[model samples]
Target chain A: MTLKKWIKTPKGYVAIAMFAFLIIAAIGYKDSHGIKNAFTAVFAGVIVDIILNIIKRRKWTLPEGAVITGLIIALILSTATSILVVGATAVFAILSKHFLVYKKKPIFNPAAFGLLFSFLFFKTGQSWWGAFGDLSVWTILFLLVGGYMVANRIHKFPQVFSFLGTTFVMLALMGYFNIGDAVDALRPPFINGTLFFAFFMLTDPPTSPAKDKDQVIFGFLTAAAGTLVYAAFGGLIYLFIGLCLGNLYTYLKKRSVSKSMVNRKGFISTHR
Target chain B: MVKMDKKWVILCSTAVAAAYTSGFYSTETQAVKMESAQHNQISLHTKVQQSGTTGNIANYALNQQNKKAKQKYKDGTFTGSGMNRRGDIQVAVTLRKDKIVDVQISNWGMHYSESDVVDLPGQVIQRQSANVGIVSGATYSTEAFTDAVQDAINQAQNS
Candidate 1:
């Protein structure tokens, strides 16, 4: 599809917003490394996603999802990270979307899964720069407004609210009890990162729930699990782990509902 | 029976969470600021006492002698820890003949690569001082490293 037509779609609009975010974030950095890292990640994401699509469908396809994934990874990672590492992380993210599947759908957010892998293996630092975290505190207003628009447009406000609410409550409790390092998440960059993740990654339609109640549960589960991980291990990967676990819950829930539907159909047919 | 909409639930939860978090964060930050301020005042008071009156010249000479004497290490390896917002960093400093022979970073909890601050330890040994140039990309890591080295030097002086 042409760029003009694509922009009219929800996904294309989101892609354009993400690109705008990338440009804004890149300007905050001291040097050209920010743009370089973003470029490398996006380039790698596009190439790998195209290859994977060709392999799966035996035809060329424009990979919007891959581009978004790349931009996210670039934004999250430290601007000081090597270009090669950025590219490798993008490839890994795209690879997860292609390989880790359940019922022809990915069982996890590809970007989250890939970022978790990078944290474990590469020890890459995540500054969450793409959320405009490095800039002045007023930039949070931009994140909030943009995120609200996206969530509202996608009708994922419940999911975003539940996740953010649960997270803040958990952080407050942790701070009150002096439980763990999780309380540091209340600060900037981390707060911005959490907001970014909720708006962009958690609201992923296919991996999350549709119904309002289910969406609330999904958000609550994700925040609770991620907070627990932070309490235990106190690492940056907790957010990613939480999102992946929530994805697993969604997958299982979907499977059970489909199974029951099949059984009900079989029962009626047999009775007839 | 009246049923609340999902939107109400979301709005309520968000408000409560925000208020609770802000309350806790405010108290914690205030406490930290107060504690640091007191610490700074105490250090400043000590500095004023050390440089006060005609005794300043005598004190300066004595302080220099004491500093030179205290700078000498007893020749062994010591480990020290420095903690920041990110996490703790532990470093081991090896000393010989009243000079630092080697400094090794044993563990760090920062997000940036270790390679970013790898040159720091070498600089410490060359200068025989923990006040090394900060790494371009790893400001926090460098601060933590220097603090850890300073902690090790303190241990060496006490030993």
Candidate 2:
């Protein structure tokens, strides 16, 4: 799709909304570094995506999804991280989308995987500054408003709703029980991080299930996994890890179903 | 019928196991550090008394730590660095006799460690105590902040 037509798609709106929220946050922090990091990630992500796409398909394709992934990765990084780290992360994210395919589609959210692996590799900060948590309580308005627009456009309400509702209530329970002060995760960066993940990344079209029932299970699994990881490792990487786990579940279920069909038909590799 | 994905169950369980292991390690290390800090403080108290030192902030602070339960840092600007596995938290503090006049953190793990700094300095100045609790969810930052502050306090006490 042309850039104009592409922006009208679901991914387009999400990307633009995320970028807008980021700018608003950068302005609020009065730190140009945030904007710079985001742009660096985007530039790097787009370039890598285009380069890889050309190599694979022998035609040029705009990196719409990669752009969104880049922006999310940048926003989640510590605003103080170097541009080189941000660019490296963006490149890795695009690479995952290009090479980590299960069946002509990547099985993980590129942004989520990029952030998770980048964090594991670099051990840098994940301030999640894009949520504008440092500014003021009223700033949640930006997340709510923009997130609503994206989630509504994509029609992934079931997944988003389940993940968010379960995450909040479960985190509150963790807080009530005083698990890692997990209830604290319901505040500031964590809350914003959860909401952003729910409304944006968790709804990744290719990796997530669309069926209402599966979506609910996937969402609950993601939250359960996230809480478990957070209570254990006590870092911000839990969200991405949880989502990846959920993606693994989906990919496995699909594979298992296909395998069963192959076995019944007495044929090898029937699904493929 | 594969009612549920077996791989899903496996991955989820594995994540839980890893989380538990990490949490256990973090808590154990924290306990050790607390014990060490307390142990060091007790031993240092005895040594300072035997030395019959006058105008030593550690002695006065210990007396206060027992009496008012904590305060009386020395006057001057001192820097302290708290080390953890991930990195260190370095803080520069200015004190006026028994009161903390100012605190500016120079480096905090170079990353998410600032979560601890959000309101910690203000709290340190307000309470005038480095024994203040850490910011929830900012454990690394909190430990580093108090550790570095205590380090600086040690410098102030000795000098």
Candidate 3:
């Protein structure tokens, strides 16, 4: 697609928004490491995506999805994380798309899967420092604007609705039941970063359910699983884990109906 | 009731199992972090206090206050906890009569290099209430710290 054509695509729009988030994060954090981490992730992700595509005999392509994935990982992971871990995660994330396949496409959200793997192997902290959490309350306005645009453009409002609704409702239940001190998570960084995830990551086109009904179910289940994860285990990886499981559920649901239901081209999507 | 997808059912079941297992793990990890936080404060305050008493920083502070003034409030240390971004934060307040003589930030589970909580204890001590003072730019940690200090103060006031 031409730059003009790509700019109009849903992924293109989201990519712009994601980059805007990076700029906002850089400004809000006012730290050189976050900016460097963002570049490292983007560079690593793009390089890996190119190398993998060439090795697989695919055409040379602009790896926008990989860039988005790298940016998300950089933004979400702790800015204090070693640059080596950041670069490794971006590479692993791109590799996950190539290796962890469902009908030759990645099964989980690449960033989520990559971050989860990094967490297990590296024990790297996920500060979600991209949310500008420690900065002004005004930061939320940017998230809200970007979130609304992307969610609206993709017609994934129901998924966002269901996920946030179910997660907060579950959180409310935890509060009522006094379930293992999860209420404190409703505060700034955790809550803000989680909302950003729901709006951006959980709505990935290939992995998430398309229909409104399925999306509602998908969102609720994701939230329920995440809440369970958060309340029980207590870590920063709950959102990523929830999305990974939700993706698995969607894949299984489609596979159960018919093998032909999924599009092969969707997996090979160079733009998205 | 609508018939749910079989795959969904299985996934939900798996989620429940995962949650159950993780809950246990979280509790254990939190306990370990709490134990270590006690150790960090010891290393931190040894030179700051010059007394070399690590385990009972709050108690030692209370004793120092006792030497200078007749006991005004209940003579004991109190502890309270609240949630932070990464984990829970706990504050121990030392009291003599009605005055908050000293405060020890007992446990904070965050591994993030946060300098904000350092100012929070002093604010609570000076203000005599968790109702006052918030370190700017550290909104969530400050809120949690204030809550923890308030919890300790309330215990001291009541006792």
TM-score against truth, every candidate: 0.80, 0.67, 0.66
Q: What is candidate 1's lDDT per residue for A1-272, written digit by digit as tens? A: 78799886667767877888877776766556777887899899999888778778845657788888888888888787788888999999889888887777787898898888887777776878888766788888777777766776677877878888888888777767767754457766577888899988998776788788998899999999998988777767789999999999998998899999999999999999
True-structure lDDT of candidate 1: 0.76
Candidate with maximal TM-score? 1
- Error at A148, model 1, angstroms: 0.6
Model 2 segments more than 4 A misplaced: A1-4, A263-272, B1-159
Query: Please, what are the lDDT tens digits per residue for candidate 3 over residues A1-272?
Result: 79899987878987888888778877777777877888999999999999889899997777889988988999887776778889999998888899877777778899999999987787666777777676777887777788767877777877876787677667656655667555445655676787789878998887888887999899988988987988886667888889999988988887876655345456567557
- RMSD list, candidates in order: 6.2, 11.8, 11.9
Lowest-scoring 10 consecutive residues by lDDT in candidate 2 chain A?
A180-189
State residue B93's C-alpha deviation in candidate 3, in Å: 14
Q: How well is each residue in A1-272 modelled by candidate 2, as lDDT tens digits?
A: 68798778988898888889788888888988888888999999998888787778746555778778888988878677788989989988889888888877888899888887777777555777787756687888888787767766665666766676666666555555556645346555566777778878898888898786888799989988987887765766788999999999998988898889878787645655
Provide candidate 1's TM-score on chain A.
Answer: 0.94
Candidate 1 versus the native: TM-score?
A: 0.80
Question: Residue B148 of candidate 1: its Cα lDDT?
Answer: 75
